[model samples]
Target: MTGNAFTAVIDDTMTAPNIGEPEEDMFRLARHLGLDIQGFHTFGDAAEFPQLQREAWDAARTALDRGLPVFAKELDLGNETSLIYAYDADGYYTHSWHGGKGHEGSDAVIPWTELGRNYCPCSSCRARASSGDRPSDGVYTGDPGYGGFVSLHWASAAEPSDARRALGAALDFALSFSRRGAYGWGGRTFYSGPAAYGKWIGLLRSNAIQSFYMGYFIDLFHESRLYAYRFLLEASEHFDGRPGDELRTAAEHYGVIAKNFQSLNKLFPWMQPHAPIDDPDRRREAVELLTGIRQLEEEGWGLLERLLTWVR
Candidate 1:
């Protein structure tokens, strides 16, 4: 319940706004979830780093050799994480979000030359090609040339759960999600918190809704809100009285958000947020839908903030 779903980030350009990258608070909360992760965010092409590459490769193999799974982010999964379980001279065998061939799960190997970079490191990496391109330059969405890897290892899975402490931390995160949490990278701007909704609306108003990244954003956030609702629902049981009531109400609002996002996902499946939305009428409809979502999220955020006061 680290309140990950509470924030949304996008850039001023409104390109491939991968807002899911958790910042300081989320990382701190990871400890509570029994995950001790070490990572690096690099701003150059990884192809030049043979020594570092070999080190990472050897580490993954060592982890696998010890019957442990190695974790890395933005490894051929369009700004997502991957689980490394096998490796050889060619590359690391992973179970990336983009499964199957061209990926690590069934038949994919992330070459040492490709790991550290932005989303869609190569042509074969993207699950599908978008018919739409940037109107400014007709460029399809591609990596912004930055990359990172977060090596994850199990810390203490057997540790007893601390519902109260976790709830307090999550409540703080949820409350802050609407106010702060801005980020930037590779000369690109990003907006998180409730402001992210406004960024989406702005993009919709621009009438240049990205086909691929837009769709990916919807699919990812929709799923996140779904989990937000479910987690809050379960979180209620750990509390008593008004705080519990407030959490339940907040959860209901998130449920609304999840349902609407599900509908939005259908409108923009996979990485096609601009599917039928390229049309003016449908685009206007999407604007309206996104506007409603923004309002609902803010209302839910308000409830969460209030719940924090009561719980504290």
Candidate 2:
């Protein structure tokens, strides 16, 4: 855990005329990172023949041996909007390409197999799903856990019979996607949409108490490693009314999590983009805040392990 500056070096250098072999590049990168490269076997392009699969496996093993998780991050301020769009633009299940012809069932963020069945069509889902219409090319995969190809159709009034129908439809869609796993994996990728600026504000405003409670409750369960249901129960406890002991208890537990995650700011910074301090005087402050957040995430895991006993 090197804070926010996580980097992974892959073998990108090529050799043709005395440049050297691919393993040489790998060794160079490892050495550049100050890592000792003893007993390192260079992986080359030996998968061009009949046993191509074996070559790929060997290459994959080489990657794993280096212990990389492919973590990535952007270090620019103005790039936020572009990055968001670029991420969201990928794949076919997103709102960008819901109804495009020939691109059916392309979203792979969600488990297409169990999408409709386990899809949580709560406010979060609706808000994100309604961001944009399906794309012309049908390449935008929707949210995770929800396949991109499924049509958006929910009855306003709940009908007892409709429950069964919805379940059946979800299951059928999940099965269809499961059958096409290979295609979806290679051809499709998914990204979550930006939060509903206004709706999110309104929800946060209208139910600040409960919302905060739920947020904290979730953090508590996460911190303590308690049953995740504890957070849900606490959230449900405060949802109908304002906040009370239950919610407060949840918040207290979450406070511990917050103390741990305060550096990283939120459990998921991707959920909201924090404003960067632009003033020269505040620049250091901003950097410190961001750095602190990275520290929280790095150190919080250990705290989580220790706090597991407090979990529900």
Pick the lDDT winner. 1
The whole-model C-alpha lDDT of candidate 1 against the native structure comes to: 0.64
Q: Estimate the TM-score for candidate 1.
A: 0.74
Model 2 CA RMSD to the hidden true structure, in angstroms? 21.6
After aligning candidate 2 to the native by TM-score, how far in Å is the CA of 26 from where it should be?
38
Instruction: Residues 171-285, candidate 2: write the lDDT tens digits.
Output: 2332222222111111232111111112222333333223223233223324432322244234334333332333344444535434543433343333322332223443344
Residue 53, candidate 1: alpha-carbon lDDT: 52
Q: Considering every candidate listed, which one attains the maximal TM-score?
A: 1
Model 1 agreement with the true structure over 42-67: per-residue lDDT tens digits:
43433534445556666666667866
Every model's TM-score:
0.74, 0.21
Give model 2's TM-score versus the native structure: 0.21
Worst 10 residues of 2 by lDDT: 72-81
**lDDT (C-alpha) at residue 292 in model 1:** 88
